[model samples]
Target: MKNYTVVAKDSFTVLGIGTELRSDYTDYAGITKEKADFWESIKQDGRLETLKAVATNNYIFAVNEAVNNKMMHYAGVMTEASVPEASRLIQFPKGEYLVVKGEAQTAEELSNKLTGIAFGQVLSEVKDVAYVGGPNATVEMGQQNGILFGEMWIPVVRK
Candidate 1:
């Protein structure tokens, strides 16, 4: 059995990353890797008072808390305005997600794990809601490798 610990998440600010069809599932590695690299450089370059990291796949971005200020394109997941297309509407359902934590000291490590897991297991959690289609996402805060780690949230629909 896949082991998952149930826990309540603290409400945290996030960057809701969106991508067009061309950007979805395609060139995910190239695009996300660059973003993660850029974010990581922010600290070393002294652009960020605290370090920030962002990892991306074609459909999602795993971003650090320091990137919170750069978060935009929020489909307002916290608000009711983000309902799916009217004709495409279904019961607004939420799921029991298997949120996972990982640590990658550098941009490459973080990017690889995120992109791999994103298209691998997390997509398995949500059944029919645009795994390949463009969707905004949530990424939160955590710690690992004695460094700040980010938590990626994949909103799944309950069975």
Candidate 2:
């Protein structure tokens, strides 16, 4: 069984470069590819590195949100600093959050695994809290013993 917890968090902001995903929300493969491509583009062009230079920590955040009724994804960092290349500043409110933690062989795998477990298993099985659909993120905290580890943070309201 997947392990998860509900935790309280203070407000935070992430500076990011984003793309509006064109794939249907239910098309997991398509959305994954789009997010992968977006990450590759940001890395290849040094946007990710630029963000990292000003980051408060080494953690990388992959954020998913809906804006103007369109599915949007972002590669971001927790930073108070702003860059001209950033497409948006994502705001996560102060509230309870559904936090799912896990590890994988790679950052990509970690993201997919955490996302799947959080959305497919944890959220569906858990009671008392419900995700209300704000900007949720898979935070790539770091690696240990050659394994990538992180947590998925989804804002939720107590039901």
Candidate 3:
């Protein structure tokens, strides 16, 4: 069984710099490439570092959400403060969340692994809750033993 847990969480806001994901929803490879490219651009341009400077903690958040029928992705941090360069203040509603944890050699691998496990395996097996759709995130908390570790948090509703 995939290692996961459902937990209650308080509402929080993430300040982010975002881009609309243009790939078809069914195209996993396209979507993954778009996300990877976006992250690379942000990192190279110092956008990620700017967001990190205002972060409440060291955790870096890569969030996905559908906004007005458009697939949106963000590189963000948890903070009440805002930067003029930020694209949005994404809000995560207070609720139960399906949390999937994992670690990998790189942040990119860790995100892909956790996301695959969460959607491809765990969400399908869980009987008591369902993901109703909002902003979901892959939180890159830190590194340990040269490995990147994080958790994917998807808000869920109990069935």
Candidate 4:
């Protein structure tokens, strides 16, 4: 899967990747609060190890994660200076994306299906895809009961 460059919309997305502290995310509720800390700690202490674990395709993208309805507020530790009001959420880069399409029953169901299917199944069959969209950013398919469609987007190093 050779990477292609295309402009992407700027928006918010919940990035869920990297080795989960609690495998299976059985403790999903505890994940987010520790996410920033985990990222920062690695960024500071183990720069080289962090770089080796995986490659980063930093690009602007929009995806929806089902609001777990559980609020994990960080007291807005990020001040107004860091992020302007116009852009409430921040994405890594200006543009470019790798997209995947999927249809399923629920957002969660769809997400699960995509994770298991799009990446887990498809990539295994197509090894080059690893060189393209390195990792995906999950998006909650539009609101629907019992079923929905989700399109996963990843930042690929543009060809």
Error of 2 at 52 (Å): 0.6
Inter-residue clash pairs, candidate 2: none
How do the predictions measure up, each by TM-score? 0.45, 0.97, 0.97, 0.40
Worst 10 residues of 3 by lDDT: 79-88
Task: Report the lDDT tens digits of candidate 4 across residue range 1-159.
Answer: 532323364543333223234323454445543544554554576542333233233221223222233322111111122322121232434355555666676434455555555555554454333424222454543545555655656554433
Clashes (candidate 2): 0
Residue 124, model 1, lDDT: 62
- Counting clashing residue pairs in each candidate, in order, gives 0, 0, 0, 4
lDDT tens readout by residue for model 3, 19-105 = 999999889999999999999999999989889999999989989999999999999999978887799999999989999999999
User: Over the full model, what C-alpha lDDT does candidate 2 score relative to the true structure?
Assistant: 0.93
Point out the higher-scoring one by TM-score: 3 or 4. Answer: 3
